[model samples]
Target: MNAQSPKTVDDTRLDSVIYQDGIMRISYTLTKTSKDEIDSDAFTKDKKALAASVSCDEKGLGQFVKSGLLIKYTINDSSSAPITDFQIGKSDCL
Candidate 1:
């Protein structure tokens, strides 16, 4: 039997995002922006910034962020392959 790798998302200026063993964990910071302000347009406009701010890939993470799920108080960790299709959401930084 093979063991799967743990999924993870880094803390942002406003919140922390993590996925471990299929469970998604999202915690907000004191500076966390209001959820009401986080809309599709805002997410779309800030995709790059959001991706950069977090520890996830711009493209993969963009999918979830664009979906407005990131703003939620709770979210389910996707089974999708990390950094592949709708997955972990981590990107390589130079």
Candidate 2:
């Protein structure tokens, strides 16, 4: 499931993906950016885009969404310290 992990997404690296407790957690690490450098409000607004993709995608997270699982996106700084966590669920798609 994580064959494509360690992938780079924009300014961050998607480190890994884990599923447990009805949640699918996608972890990312900043490559050239830092926690302090992120604007929380703008970063959070990005969740709408993520939600849209999940709802419209047929080949990616469609199956997961159908399962009604909570999808979580977590960010960590370059120092391996957690920065922020965002969660999207079935309701988010609607």
**Best candidate, lDDT:** 2
Clash count for each candidate, listed in order shown:
6, 0
Q: By TM-score, who's the top model here?
A: 2
Worst 10 residues of 1 by lDDT: 76-85
Cα lDDT listed for each candidate: 0.36, 0.76
lDDT of 2 by residue, 1-94 (tens): 5887899868779899999988888888888767788776787678557655764366877667766878888878888777778777676665
Error of 1 at 13 (Å): 6.0
Candidate 1 wrongly placed segments (more than 4 Å): 1-18, 22-24, 29-40, 52-94
RMSD of each: 12.1, 2.5
- TM-score of each predicted structure versus truth: 0.24, 0.75
Q: What residue runs in model 2 are displaced by over 4 Å at the alpha carbon?
A: 2-4
